[model samples]
Target chain A: MAELTTLREAIAGLVHDGDTVALEGFTHLIPTAAGHEIVRQGRRDLTLVRMTPDLVYDQLLGMGVARKLVFSWGGNPGVGSLHRFRDAVERGWPAPLEIEEHSHAGMANRYVAGASNLPFAVLRGYVGTDLASVTPTIRPITCPFTGEELMAVPALRPDVTVVHAQQADRAGNVALWGITGIQKEAVLAARRAIVTVEEVVDAFAPRPFQVVLPGIAIDAVAVVPRGAHPSYAHGYYDRDNAFYTAWDPISRDRDAYRAWMQRHVLDVDDFAGHLASLAAVA
Target chain B: MTAWDTDEVMTIVAARELRDGAVCFVGIGLPSEAANLARATHAPRCVLVYESGTIGAKPEVLPLSIGDGVLADHADAVVSVPEIFNYWLQAGRIDVGFLGAAQIDRHANINTTVVGSYAEPKVRLPGAGGAPEIAASAGEVVVVLRHTTRALVDRLDFVTSVGHGTGAGARDALGYPGRGPVAVITDLGVLRPDPATRELTLVAVHPGATADQARAATGWPLRVADDLAVTSSPTGEELAVLRDLRARTAASRGGPTRPVRPTGR
Candidate 1:
């Protein structure tokens, strides 16, 4: 059974230095609060993994919390570059970050393979692309029956997987809707899983396209309303697009990046405090 | 008629490529706008599949990102990311893969990865998201980007997605499923692959753009069709719908009326 806990406690209990951690949310339901907590707790050398390493990973990368990133794409979504990520890769500002890249299909399948407890997943991908040449995990395999050649990627089994959701029942069953992305596979693929939800509800009414992660699969359920903040939580709030655009300038300069992190993420006691600080500034 | 910029004409031309009821797997930025414009204008039944797993997404306003709540809220179905890639894309259920790239070569090969070396870089672009598989697996592919010497290069710094590989028979030899890039639409005009050589050739230029300008903009030894057609200007209705879409998107994002140009990934 999953324990109901605070975001800080969940991060402290689940994440560790040098762990392979996945904070999975495609473009919505991103675990921003959990990522912030990981930054606050001062974890180091984590192999931070996500399909799209959005603002949260940019923060973690800027703080030197990750020594490596295993992802498909690292960008500010509709915005341009994740400046901190670019800095880390280009100049090694905070650290010389190593990256193991894959295409979205490859990454998603890796998670699916991991969730299925399979050794590797096969797909008709990377046939003529440079990805197969660079990524060590991608290799060619021949189909025994049809004699067709395909690509195989090793399963991604993270040490901890963290996600943000809309609600968690009293029984710690997490229910999320609206672009659930790869959260379920990420959670199932990890040795430990943490879910930060907008609220703890009595029971799930079960919305369309809803995914419910039973308490048995989760390690902890943290109630942090609006945990996805800059990223939206479907019905809870809209995506803060201005903040995403605002991040560009703040992350471009090292000093501004540091100052922003110090003020918004590090100095705050928790996510609520972080929200309060932003509100005060606004 | 209302005046339309090159970017506007480029979007209109790209939107016109999609057939009614065609399933287009949309990349963010230009391709998204074009696909949405097609749905809003001529091809109302055109299905938009976003990488975020929103299949057949019909958004009222342009989405700031692929996984915006509007996409999911209006989608026919929302599947897991793995399923979207595996069951839909890799399974060849998609009819078209509409993409934009930082760099494209003579063969329509793309580079959204890096500017210099992979080991040590000048600029580290966002690596391949779904472009590789989309470029490989869709029935056909459509590329949309601004026409510049920097983008329409002789050779890519890195081949993030293979269009026709080296040239004709390359995709076939490599056993790629898709029919590579059928059209490379840009601000200047449209370049379709040469049926024999599979090299992208300038088939049409926009009204104000000349073949010489297109040639000057491309890094390679550009090829032009024998009877290169000058594209028609954007119709009033097309411009109105596109501008309205942009205005609504900008308003929702709390920005200026014009949608910002996407910086290369």
Candidate 2:
């Protein structure tokens, strides 16, 4: 059963140095607060896994918390490049970050394989692309029955998977709707999991197309309202598009990025404090 | 028709490529705009599948990202990411995989990965998201990118997705199920794969864009169709709808009326 806890306690108990951590959210319901808490706890050398390593991953990478990144795409969504990610990959500023890349299909399948407790996942991907040539994890496998060749990718089983959701019941069952990307797979695939929710309710209202993670699968549930800020929580609020565009300039320069992080992340007591700081600035 | 920009014509031309009821796996940015335009105008039944697991998404305004809340709110079904990739895309349910790239070669191969060496320095672009499989398994693929010598390159820094791999028999040799890129829509014009060589050839130039200009913009000695056609200008209705969409998207995102050029991938 999941123990209801605070975000700081959840991060301290669940995440560790050199752990393989996945903060799974596509665009909506991203665990920004959890990621911030992990940074605050000063974890180091984590092998961070995500499909699209957006602003949160960029922050973690900028802070030198990750030694490697296992992901598909790394960009600022509709805006531009994740400048801090580029700095780490290109110039090795702060640290030389290693990357193990794959296509979205490949990454998604890996998570599925992990969730299923399989060795590897097969797909019709990277056949004629250079991804297979560079990433040793992607290999060609011949079908035993059909005599057709396909690609095989090893399963991704993270040590800890963290996700943000709309709500959690008193029983600790987490439920989220609206673009629930790969959270379920990531949670099931990990050894332990933490879910940060907007609120802990008595019962779920049962929204359409909602995914509910049973308390049995989760290690802890943290209540942090507006936890997915910058990213949205479907009905709670809209995505902070202005902040995304604003990130480009701040992340472009190293000094600026560090100063911004020091003020918004390191100096803040918690996610609520971080939110207050942003509001104070705005 | 009223005055229109190059970007408008390119988007309109790309939108025209979609069949009325085709299932399009839409990439964000330009491809998303084009697919949405088709739905808003001609192809009302055109299904838009975003990789974010929102199948048949029908958003009122353009999504800033692939996994925007509006997409999920308006989607026919919201499956898991794994199901979207395996059961839908890899299963060959997608009819058209519309994509945009930073660099494309003569054979339509894409490079959204890097601008230089893989091991070392230069620009590190966003790695392949779903383009590899989309380029491989979709029934057919349509690519859109701004035409410049830098973008229409002879050699890619990295091959992120395979189009017509080396030449004619490439996909056949590799046992790929889907037909490779059928059309590459750009600001200058449209380039369709030559049936004989499987090389992208200039089939049509957009209005006000000359064949020489297209050739100059390409890095290689670009091939031209024997009877190269000059594409018709964007119709008034198309321009109006496109502008309206852009305006609404801008208002929602707190952005300028015209969006900045999208980054690689």
State residue B49's C-alpha deviation in candidate 1, in Å.
0.7
Candidate 1 lDDT, A123-195, residue by residue in tens? 9988878878888999999999999999999999999999999999999999999898999999999999999
Candidate 2 at residue B130, lDDT?
80
B176: Cα error in model 2, Å: 1.3
Tell me how each candidate scores on DockQ against the true complex: 0.81, 0.82
Top-DockQ structure, candidate number? 2
Screening candidate 2 with a backbone cut-off below 3 angstroms (N, C-alpha, C), the clashing residue pairs are A104-B129
Question: What is the C-alpha lDDT profile of model 2 across B1-265, one tens digit per residue?
Answer: 4988899999999999999999999998999999999999999999999999998899989998889988998789998888898999889899999999989999999999998999884999988988888888899999988999999999998999999999999999988889989999999999999999999999999999989999999999999999999898899999999999999988887767443444434
The interface RMSD values of the models, given in order, are: 1.2, 1.1
Point out where model 1 deviates above 4 Å: B257-265
